[model samples]
Target: MADDNKAHTAISFHEAAVAAIEAQKERLVRQVTLLQSKRAYHLSAIRYYKGLITLARRLPPEVLTYIFQICIDLGYPRTPLNVSGVCSEWRKAALAPTLWSNIVVDPDSDERSLQRRIKFRLDRSGLAPLSISLSLSRSAVFMNVLAMLMQHTHRWSSLYLTAESSQEVDHFLGIFGRASFPLLSNIGLRLSFTGGEVPLGVDLQEPPLAFGDAPRLNRLSFHAIIPQSGLFYESLSLLKITSLILATTPRHQDVELLRLFTCLPLLQTLILKSKISIVDGDIGTIAEPVHLSWLRKLDITGEIEMLNLLPFIQTETLSHLHLRAVVPVSEEEQVQGSLADCLHSFIATQGHALEYFELHGFYLSAVHMSSYFTHLPNLVELQLHDSDISDEAIRLFSGPDACCPKLSKLDFRWCGQVTGKAMVSMVQNRLRGSHNLHSINEVTLIHCSFVQEADVLDLAALTICRLLGKPDDYCRGSTCCQNERYRQRLQLRQMFGVGGRVRKLTKNLIL
Candidate 1:
């Protein structure tokens, strides 16, 4: 009996130990399950915070839309598609139709792919007004494309057409000129002939290009074209146009061109180009000057003698004048009412209102330059390029009696006669605010060999200075050269990386 009881006690102890181990195992499994749930919860929380910190998420919808529009304006190809893929919020913002409204049809792309892209953009743009730029070739395929685009003429806000020949231009105008573009406000047409010469005669049987119904058109540009009755009758009828750019042929006379300006009394900006010819007898006989009363900006490129016409252009509101003399004048021509004389006459009449003036490829005496400063007291910016402006002119620009009290910006390029010492004195006096003269805000010197390295460094300390194309000695140890190199490197980087395939769009906003 004693042996049996000892054996039973040992059996009961083993069973109890096994039961305790099973309960411990169950508790450990429950702990592991709870920890895993906590781990997943923490991970979820981390992802939520990460998304909240993104720039795309934090930006307001309107700001993000504006940045996207700028990207599109900068010609980021497939901008909407690219930005949409970045995130959900970006995709929502990219849905804006305004971002996809600029439709450009390049002549160089594959025909099939180009058509598909056009369709895609048109669909995404919805009812937004389209700014269309079409670069066309001699291919017949483009005709079908043009026909397709014509379907949306009512939606065009701006139209730019470039062609290789007059035939293409004629064909394009035949289609578009007849259609009524209710929203069209700007039009640009560039044409090139086989020999870069506009043909002598027009086919009278053909109708003239006219947009009689385009009442909203306020800006027009004609490149490599002359304004002729048979070619642009309706265009000339646009007396309400605020801006006009004309590239005239050598056949255009000074008086005829002046008469053309008289028709557009509301012109705010005018750019005229013609081959150089001295305006003589007939121009001086006019009783009254052509009053472009609303004119604010005038750019004339051609003969230095064009300034003679300025005496007949009466506008007290003209603020910006850019004169570039591209023709070579004989030494004899310079002696009789030279460029200086013409400018002197113009200043006497209209210089008081000039805020910005640019003179290129001409010579002016110190006396004439000082007279300009004296007359243009409101002048705020002066640009002199490849000219003979002497040190005396620079000296006259300084001191308490400075001529242009509001002058703040000076741009000098290839001005070999101007020295570093004179420039330094001018900057010092202007920055010191002598006689309450406006402090010099910016100075740009390009290929000005007389400016030394030390001068650039000193001027840099006083104001914003841009030095470029300097001589070897002047460039060494100067930040100007370093900054140029950095710009070049940055340009190269932008040209070859990420959005490299898409070229920057040319600005044709008609502003």
Candidate 2:
């Protein structure tokens, strides 16, 4: 009787709990159904409101077309045709002349259907100034498209042509005869041979490549091209070019190169290949330095004769000098010191007008820098590339009486001799001391094998943004959010020698 009573009591309690649970479940179901209905209504409202704020309805047709035009001017990714396919108003907006003014045509692509699309774009581009960019290869022969585009030569604002062969580029340029490009302001030509070694040389023995009709051409760039005829060079030099860049192969002799410079009287920026050096005995009496009054920036790259050419060019307005020095295999030993001495003298003669100096591809030692350390007090930015920099140079740079007092940027890449400890000491001297009053605001080290990454992190505490190694190193740029070095920072855990803890870091710890 006692066992039966216990069992009956348990069954009665179980039935009570089940009844309560069923009632609660039904209530929850009704509540969930009402909540779901509310969610669906909210979603429907969002869709309805969003549909009203589209480009066509929110912006006027003319305003929308203007926006599309601005996008094209700023390098829009999609063609205007694709942007217009969304709606009727957009289609009409895409028909604006500005939307199709800047056209890039490639003959190597599907030549038939792409031409039709380009034709439609050209039609929409009616009466607008056209900036034409053409890319051609060795075998590409699209004369019909070229002729069609040339019909708008009067409206060409900028012309950029990249051809794989001299013959191909010459063929395309052959149509310029008797044609006028009245509005052309900029022209960039890259003469690249497909399977040949670069700086590909173009023999300008053929008829002079002419663009004399473009009266307003202010900037010109020629890559890997050599004009054999004085006519070709003379024709281009006649323009009032404000900026000129000549980086080519089959390097011209010093006299031939200097003759080209004498032609351009209005050049404001000149970048040229420097190969031949003027030896002490070779230069007779130094002629008067050529005056380039408007010239402010000079980039002398490729096998530079730092001592030879600088004396012949006088510019009081020069502010930036980027010397990418490729010391000849024969002159590597003395080039750095010789160059340092030469540059100091050059700056002295120019009244120290340089504010930005970049010395690249030379092996620098303490002797190399000792000459110029006190010479350039106005330098604000300095870059040393693939240099043999040492601790002594670093110490002098960070010394109490160091030159370059206004220098805020120090960028060095592939420096093999600089050790991390010296850099740390230099940085620490700047951080803690008040005597030198270190003002270095930015430090960028790229592929310096001896400078440990940890030392760079120490500098990071003081820096606002830091870039380390190649851009492709940090999770292949996945975690480059706001420029954080993920892979490198994680390595700090391993840096905590025997103990496996990440270094306990805090703000002002480097202080």
Q: Which model scores highest in lDDT?
A: 1
What TM-score does each of the candidates earn?
0.68, 0.65
Q: What is the C-alpha lDDT of each candidate?
A: 0.71, 0.66
Q: Alpha carbon lDDT of residue 150, candidate 1?
A: 81
| Model 1 steric clash pairs | none
- lDDT by residue for model 1 over 347-417, one digit each (tens)? 77787889999887666655666677778888999987655567888877777677888989887876767
Full-model lDDT, candidate 1:
0.71
Candidate 1, residue 80: lDDT: 80
TM-score, structure 1 vs. true:
0.68
Clashing pairs in 2: none
